[model samples]
Target: MANIKIVLADTDDKYLMPLERKFIDGLEDKADLIVITDPDYLKEYFSEPQRVDILIINEELYDAELERHNIASVFILTEQELLNNNTGDAEANRIYKYTSVKEIYAEIIGKSSARSETLNTKEETKILMMYSPIGGIGKTTVSAALCEALAKYQKKVLLIGIDSLQTIGSVIPQLPFMESGTEKLLIEKSEYVYEAVKTKIINRTFDLLPPFHLSLPSLNIKGEDYINLINGIRDSKDYDYVIVDGATGFTEDLSRLMGVADHTIILAGQDKNAVYKLDCLLRNIDCSDNDRFVFVCNKYRNNRENFLANGYMTNFCRVSEYIELWTENSASEEGVLTNNRSIQKLALMFI
Candidate 1:
């Protein structure tokens, strides 16, 4: 709200005026608001590639190339939440059109705060995502242990699961999961969401935000939804870490998580097929080939990986001893292994 620049673009002033009115609080100023309803003028507006913090555009006027501009987030107005376009894909955001002005403005303000880190610290929230090229490779187990280590280190952490099959309840069966009925925290207002989220967060060793309970719901989730959900949680408190237990395989959602994560931990098994899969995964991946990512072989009885496509495995696995903890009864909240051999390095990464 302090330094955000907002642009509302559409073909009708009837809609623009009211929407602009919502943000024009004369007290301290929410943001720098610019409204343009003319298509030709809108074209000229972006003809020079201006810097806009938030761009709210109609679906017809939207393009996939706008992301190249100096924009932090783009909210595309759509008639339906799900798009029927088979050729094009969803952008950073897709806000349902014809919703109440209050709801739409709420989205803009919420996402804006997420982009600007509005009521939180100056340091951006560190999003650490956990992904695996192969399934059943103890991705969630490592995630739980890492989370506990971070918690024990006195870091405010939030672990979110998107495994669709629901492994959270199985892994940490003793701890009570914070329950909620909201669909990815997309309520009417950000203020309400911040307060509601703080209440709904389950705390034991660390905070846990329950993933969508719907079957295969992650498939329908857009990158923007993930961004909003993460930012909304961060807005509740200045979290030191937000660990995402992502799904297996290569998906748009997983790819987006990998791209956005401050540190992405990829888990693989200890075998030839594991090496081949991990090799091919790094070979064709579109994510940044930087130190932000690391590959670990789970269930390491011995050093079996020669290298992935990038060169060498980041490390041997977290150790096969944790395999016994994969049972439904072992990952009990009190039984989580906080004092691990390698996870302490992860805990020190933030320090």
Candidate 2:
């Protein structure tokens, strides 16, 4: 578990005093704050590689220092200032832009309900599924990144790898496991689904459930069987998020998982085949009215513009905001996730 690092940049010492105190008071032991007014030291702060989670910047200092640093930042202003500027439009997701010191405290505590839920009520682990039809995109990457993000505020998050072949490189940088298999659980056929479902939980929160032997050509599981397994985990009242890294294409198992999912995120690569597959999958899915769904475009390039112009999406999830982060000059060379900075920023976006 890493501590929440915050950078506070303001020119006035009087304004900076209360903001620093409020931040420390809000998060207590959970956060660390660095106050800076010198523009020269801005590069020095970010150059250390210890990515700051949130940057609380005054409106006056925002434009000068905001030169595309790798961090999740929020403009710190007075309540009157936020309303005057109408800063809420800049907020990408569930995060709220705070106007006052008190509001900042509320944002930190409000979003962090997973810990409080355990103390007050029987916590129910909500399962989230990240699924898509095509491969070589960012389904697996998004799943892993979402897990990393959710783990920021919530202490308990499990990223399960249930794809057919096996998922090895997504969560963290690692050497391939020679015999990663979910076959043992299949063979056990236990009435206790927990025993079967729970395996290889790494980092602080993520749990990895290995797939059947990768060497094998095919792997299959019934739709009902997957639902039962997920239900058993949900019944435990332990984790906050049960994120499923699904297999490519629409399978019975995938449908079962998606059907039960509270929120589903579909990743579409900027490719013609991927678009076609996404269209077919959306048409086939029998989703309920209340289910939350979203579309994320990965490896975005000129093809994305073409896809949007063609009006690709047919049903479910909004495609208004396409997420494209990885750049070609990145270390991965394949335009996939290669750096921790992008990974950390992505983690914050989902969190």
Candidate 3:
């Protein structure tokens, strides 16, 4: 528990004493309760805004005093204020108001815990999506290998393979897993997507939700569906990160995937055709003008040295990172390319 410094703003010492006691009792030693007996004390503390994480206000301070002070603060409100006022919008990420002391404590504690968890790590939960053109270019291999490398950090990770391709079973067979199926969580209808995913989550070092046994390719997913799903998972209080293994090439779904991604790693290999398609895909993107699309040269051999050196293609695509790994089965638990140091550098693009 973090020691939270709080400022209580209310009139009348008799009423203030019980509320202060209730707030302190409700917090359970998680806060250093500082009761401001006088409005002057509120002014004194407001001068040093750094001291308080939360402020409790009564009916008395709602009007001109609140406007005059104009302190940017998290607020705790009485039951009447919470029941009466419906002005606050959920869209705006500010001025969280709690009705009771217990509710206030929970919100502060939960937020504080989340902040602490983020501070303790170099890599936190990242919602990442991998895309490419044509399946032979090793999107599955890259996704699986990346998941393996992510698992090495001992953080909870989730890998969800969008059911555009039905061959995910053949991709990674080493682990005991299940499919969320295109039936439950369609990329078009964002409703109940998380619940569908939650059921199919194969709990392990990294949980995977592969495609279902049945075919449902006609599911026309929209841009909004992808947006909602990505936002839901990103805002989800659980898991350190999310990895989306999407189909090769640009569809509405893929465009939505790239749009919400913190970083998109495009996998390229020795095949000239695959590299050309990847180049076209990278060039066509409208997201970040900066280095958002990381070009990863995967599964390159000695024969592909000239391919990496091709200055025109490199300059056109702005190829930033390269991962040259020997062609192995790359699906087996121990045989996969997660141990390779070069791929670790590529993984840093998401980290």
Return the top candidate by lDDT.
1
Q: All models: lDDT?
A: 0.65, 0.58, 0.58
What is candidate 3's lDDT per residue for 1-351, written digit by digit as tens?
456566666766775676677666655666677776676766666654254455556544543334334333445444343322233622112223333333344434433433343223333447777777766767776776777766654446777777454565565665543443445465646565776566656765567765555443654544456567657766664666677777766777678677777677777765677666766775777534446766667766765554645756756555555666655653355345655656555554444
lDDT leaderboard ranking: 1, 3, 2
Worst 10 residues of 2 by lDDT: 91-100
- The number of residue pairs in model 2 that clash at the backbone is 1
Which run of 10 residues does model 3 get worst, by summed lDDT? 89-98
- Model 2, 1-351: lDDT tens digits are 556667777666676687688767656776677898876676576555545566666554454344455455454543242213345535311323333445444444434333333222344677788877887776776676666545544446776666666654543455235244554455344668666556544453355554444532354455555566677778876777788787787766677677788777777755677677777776887543433665666666753354633663533445533556554354343223433433444344333
Error of 3 at 348 (Å): 2.5
RMSD of each: 19.8, 11.2, 16.5
lDDT per residue for candidate 1 within 1-351, as digits (tens), equals 366678898887787777778777521354687898888888787778788878889989886666667887688888775532222443366777775665566556544554565422344678888887887777887887888867654467888887766667666765553354555454344445555566667786888866445544543545546566677766655687898988878777678767778778777665667777776677767434445766555566533433332345444222212122234454445545544545545455543
Residue 218 displacement in candidate 3 (angstroms): 4.3
lDDT of model number 3: 0.58
